[model samples]
Target chain A: MELICPAGTPAAYREAVEAGADAVYCGFRNDTNARNFPGLNFTTEEMGTAIAHGRARGVQTFVALNTFMRAGEEEVWYRAADDAVALGADALILADMALMDYVATTYPDQRLHVSVQASAANADAVNFLVDTFAAKRLVLPRVLTVAEIAALARQVDCELEVFAFGGLCVMAEGRCSLSSYITGQSPNMNGVCSPASHVRYREEGHDMVSELGGFTINRFGADEPAGYPTLCKGRFLIAEEDAYAFEDPVSLDVMDHLEALRAAGVSALKIEGRQRGKAYVAEVVSRLRKALSAPPAERPAQLAQLRRLSEGQRTTSGAYEKKWR
Target chain B: MQLPRPLAASINCLPLPLVQRAVALVFRQVLARHPGLFDRLGPYANRRFRFDPTDLGFSFVVYPAGPDITVYRAGKAPPASATVSGPLVTLLALLEGQIDGDAVFFSRSLSVSGDMEAMLALRNGLDDCGFDLPRDLSGLAGPFAPPLQRLAEAIRARALAGMV
Candidate 1:
């Protein structure tokens, strides 16, 4: 399986290529993509050079135009899709059906990928996108069990990509309504979830309280491993007790299930960190590259190195194993 | 984690002005080499960034708009739009894009307070700079550059090793 890495900037793109990414995925410096953070992503000229740089080194480039277009602002997304195809993207990862329809009709030969934001979980959804948009791949959201993914892979004709490491979204891909309700920004609509612009950390006594949109998201002790104040990962009053109502704030690491994913017809393993720095991209890509190339007996030691990089130095198989009640 | 006691004491004992002057010189060199470095900071370019090295003896106040940096003893540093507190080694590693900011922040080795967006923009800008302290410094160093570079590299390695 190919190793797909995220590159938020041109420098990170080169780092990913050097660290052994089979394909480097990035987006423009606009709201057309899910990672539309300020000072991140590439400009049109930067994307051209980045693609050329990666292509010269045998690395493929993927442009993500995965955000939904706002009404009357469809031209912005359309121009981006046209630019992506003109820039020679190996594939265009998209979530908006209208944009996908535009791409399919405009450039019949352009390779299309259904972004996880589309939440195309079942065979009907995946096949529908594949058959309609002629999507070459489907990035499965982190909501499925490994068994479920394998079953879906057997039923769909397009290649399947699974996130192997990085932040876990409790919401189904870009459908983060909890964040939207609080911050008025969501991945699908604004390409930001609990945006840093809305985050505020205040020192309350000995604990540090993180708030998003003026609501307390999490309060941490002096030594507790703190996480971003995304609403879904927050502590809330439930059943008259303080509890993590949704899920724990931890990263997903399916590194241990590479062979299973491969045997299940997964075509690629993705590292999800477009908002992360080049250092994270380089380290994760290099470590995963080594683990993938190592002998099965030696892979554990190689994979173990990534544990320190996981959120709060902790990782989970997410929904892959379905270990809970 | 704090710096080793002896090293911290040594740094503390040094004249604050001399250290400040040296830091300013290094900052000038970095700016010269990476002119548009802070452009990615966008609107936050004018914001003050207080890099409070929890392990070191001083805090640095950087004005990205001015491309200027002012250093002061830890508690004496002026207020800024945002403060990023971390070990000196981790801070340097982050500036050079040699360490993962999110990983270190998650593990509690780094902390950010006030104006989260400003800090985020600064971090993104620095990540794009691709800085290598020794190399960038050595370029500005005279004929004794090789030995100076080696010494800086050794010190950096030792400090980062202690951090790990």
Candidate 2:
């Protein structure tokens, strides 16, 4: 299977290519992409350099214009599409329908991939994207079981890609508004989820309390590892039991199931960490490359080496195994 | 009352190459485990990094040379083009990918000065190397890795406890 990697910056793009990524995806240094963090992403000039760098190394470079375009500021996202195509991105991964319509209409021959943020869960949703926008590939959301993926793969005309590893969001892609309710910056609209600007960490007696928009999302014991204060991954009081009401701070790593995913008609395996550093991209892509190349019997050993690198040093198969649901 | 800082200052008086060789031994083991890192950092092979750990109240320099990086504890300011300063744990956390480097840097917990490109390259290189000190050290140690890992954790916990 092709190993697609996330690159938040030009430097990380180079690192991903060197680490054996078949393709690397990034975004403009604006709200036009999902991971719009400060000191991250590439400028238009940097995008040109990155694509050139990737092409020289025989690695595909994709630009994510995946966030929803604001109603009045539609031109901002449209301009981003024009620039991405002009800069020679191998493909454009997009979620917004209006923007997809715009790109499909304006740049008819440009290769387009349905962003996971589009939440194209079922075969019909996948088909609609391909038919309406000529989307060459569907980056499926992390909500399907292996059986379901195979079923959808059998029905869809376009190639399918799945997030093989990275942070797992509990909410459905493109539909989550939890961060907006608290911080007024939704992933779909602003291209940020649980933006760092709104997050705050404090020490309360013996606990380290992580707050987002002044609401206590989680309180960790001094000994427990504290994660970023993302709303959906927080612990809360439900039924008088303090538990991870949404989801735990763990990463999704499914390297052991490459055979099953490939059999299910997965065209590419995408690692999901645009906010991560080059070290993360290099290690994840390199390990996945090793895992994919090894004999089926020897794959587990390679996967074991990745556990230490996971979030909170924990890894889960997530919805791929169906236990998360 | 102020003897610890003076004591640490005295320790910093050790020969730079001596401390560098000791650090280089451990870091070489880390790089040896991940060969892809050398390719990621091939562009900036000769860059120098000066790390100022305010919590530890000492400074050190690292020189990346091909497959291995040499570390130096400096008695005086390091002759590095780029210098990074942060709390000891924060610096360690950044290396381990425990926290986002940009987030910590923006929050003013970590600071970098001098050559921006070189600093950025080194940061990316370190990230690509994916060094988890305890985990990598344990892996290098083979059968005795677990005990060594526990000892490293103890040191980490004690060090972080004071900051909290």
lDDT of model 2, residue A294: 91
For candidate 1 chain B, which ten residues in a row score worst on lDDT?
Answer: B155-164
Candidate 2 residue runs with Cα over 4 Å from true position = B1-55, B58-164
Please, what are the lDDT tens digits per residue for candidate 2 over residues A125-243? 98898999999999988888888999999999999999888888767999999999999998899988887557665556656677788898987774565555688888888899989
> Candidate 2 chain B: worst 10 consecutive residues by lDDT?
B102-111
- iRMS per model, in Å, is 1.5, 9.1
Alpha carbon deviation, residue A159, candidate 2 (Å): 0.4
lDDT of 2 by residue, B1-164 (tens): 12256656765677777766766777777777765554434445577778887745457666666444545443466577677776667788777654556444424454565554456556655654556688777876788989999999887666544221
Worst 10 residues of 2 chain A by lDDT: A305-314
Interface RMSD of 2: 9.1
Best by TM-score: 1
Model 2: lDDT to the true structure = 0.78
Please give the distance, in angstroms, between residue A145's alpha carbon in candidate 1 and its true position after superposition.
1.1
TM-score for each predicted model, relative to the true structure: 0.96, 0.73
* Candidate 1 residue lDDT tens string, B50-138: 99988787899999888789989889988899999888888998898878777877777877888888988888888988898998999
What DockQ score does model 2 reach against the true complex? 0.09
Clashing pairs in 1: none
